[model samples]
Target: MHFLRYQWEPYLSYGQLFEFEKNKVVYHQGEAGRGIYYLKNGEIKVTLLSDKGDERIINMVPPGMLFGEHGIHGEPYLTSGTTTCPSLVYYFSDDVIATICRKHPEAAGIYTDSLIYKFRTLAEIIAHLDSPVEQQMAFYLLKLVQENGNASMNQTAFAKYIGTSRITVNKIIQKWKQKGYIELHKREIIIMNFDKIRAIASNPHMD
Candidate 1:
């Protein structure tokens, strides 16, 4: 869920801005996607409810990115989004999108690309759903590091992202620490050996 926001920021002048407090629900899974959202500031955790009723944080939308895009074609949202902290957001209603497309034809291609990105993301998640916990953790940890330079989240939150418990997450973090694969600094998990972590992410090598 990273995007080059500057490309669409000017056009969003036609959209409405909203402010949300920490932990507020932005949108719920299974609900109609009214329009897409662009994060102007703050963090939103985009989580999906698993078949077994567990919440898995799929992506963390940082400032200057769009989310709630799965709402294309009036379809229901495949995931739920909530504010990770007090933040500023923009709500681009369906009408707003069409209006922008009419005036700025290039914007249409970006929207199409967003849909493709969403599909590819869901496919990747499906492929990893049945993997072992460690494999799953490595996968997301690598993803986070790639997205934000480091995993800027606590173990408990990381557990939720991996659809596991905090204790289990802690155990793996400890194991990685023992191997000098990562270091816990405040809330961030800094990867020391990107190759090793990337290797584990690609295959179930942690066992």
Candidate 2:
């Protein structure tokens, strides 16, 4: 991914930096995009709202991930993005991005890999809808620990990502702790055993 460092620089003409407070809205569903975004710091919630006023947690975007650009060809955004915490993001204008793609072909590959990774994750979440809630929670936590690490996260944030309550998250943590899979300090969760955590996550039980 070191090549990504270079790909972002030459396209500076297409993007600018933006900052937001926690819970700030980045974009709305059905809204026109000024351009796609590259997350630099903090976390973001990507969600879909229903006509009936329901919402679902699609995913959380951390640094080095691309958000928006769902419909690069004049399509409206399908989901709304909001900052889960104080965040810094990079905005790339559509026109400038197009120009960069024309000038630099390698960028296309990087962008495609980012997009495909998101798509694959979404597919996994869809598959989880039918999974036992406990397994879903377990898988979500394991992935987060892998991504952001237990070092920087807390129970509340973990619950949010799994679409559960903090109390429930704590109970799951307790279970894993007794099993010697994780160690929960004041605000951080230290994964004690990755293989055991992965095994727990792979279980289908909803407990």
Candidate 3:
């Protein structure tokens, strides 16, 4: 959900603000999460570190979204958050959230919605986990385009996000470009045909 319709900004007034530089590690995985975070500006990438020491990009938090919700209420963070660019973020500790909820009961509902969104993200991850690389790539491409109008991504980041090699991502992107499914430029991908991408994203003929 976009930040405007989500209506969680007012509640963030009680949060502590922090600035982050590009590529900064906001929080590490398995750490006791002090609180949830709201992105006031720039971008944050949430990732999971596998036992094999690979970093898998899971969620990209843009401006005006709540992230790190999975780590609230004394739970350890399930993943790590790092800034993809310079960022302004608001941190809300459990006590702070409790105070807001007590003063404004509606805040609780927003938290619930945020958790629901988190669950949806997790479901998407699981759904794509076993899919072929092309399908996985298409699904995320379509989803990002639908969410942000166009996807600002490089092949390397896309490869890391989808757990593949950069060369593999480049090949698929080139094929899609030839088919007019997308227009690929440096660090950006513009969809030429959403329906066609959506079709391939759902098509699973691989053996």
**Worst 10 contiguous positions by lDDT, candidate 1:** 1-10
Q: For model 1, state the Cα shift of residue 109 in Å.
A: 1.3
Candidates' C-alpha lDDT = 0.84, 0.72, 0.84
lDDT of 1 at 41: 88
- lDDT by residue (1-207, candidate 3, tens digit) is 664333778887799999999999888899988888888998988898888999888877778788888778788998899999999989999999889999999888888888788778878987788889999998888777666566888888999889999999999999889988889677889988877888888894531
Q: Which candidate, 1 or 3, would have the higher TM-score against the true structure?
A: 3
Tens digit of per-residue lDDT, candidate 2, span 1-207: 233323455565567889999999888888865678877788878876757775656677767677876746656887788997899888877776777789898777777876676677778777776665567766876766655544446777666556668898788788889978778788777878877766657874422
lDDT of 1 at 14: 85
User: Model 3 lDDT vs. the true structure?
Assistant: 0.84
Which TM-score value belongs to model 1?
A: 0.93
lDDT of 1 by residue, 1-207 (tens): 446544568777988999999999988999988998888889999899978898888888778777898886688999998998999999998989999999999988887776687677778877888888888998888887766556899888988887779999999999999999999899899988988888888777643
Could you arrange the candidates by TM-score from highest to lowest? 3, 1, 2
Query: What are the per-model C-alpha RMSD values against the true structure?
Result: 1.6, 3.0, 1.9
- Winner of 1 and 2 under TM-score: 1
Off-target runs (Cα >4 Å) in candidate 1 are 1-5
RMSD of 3: 1.9
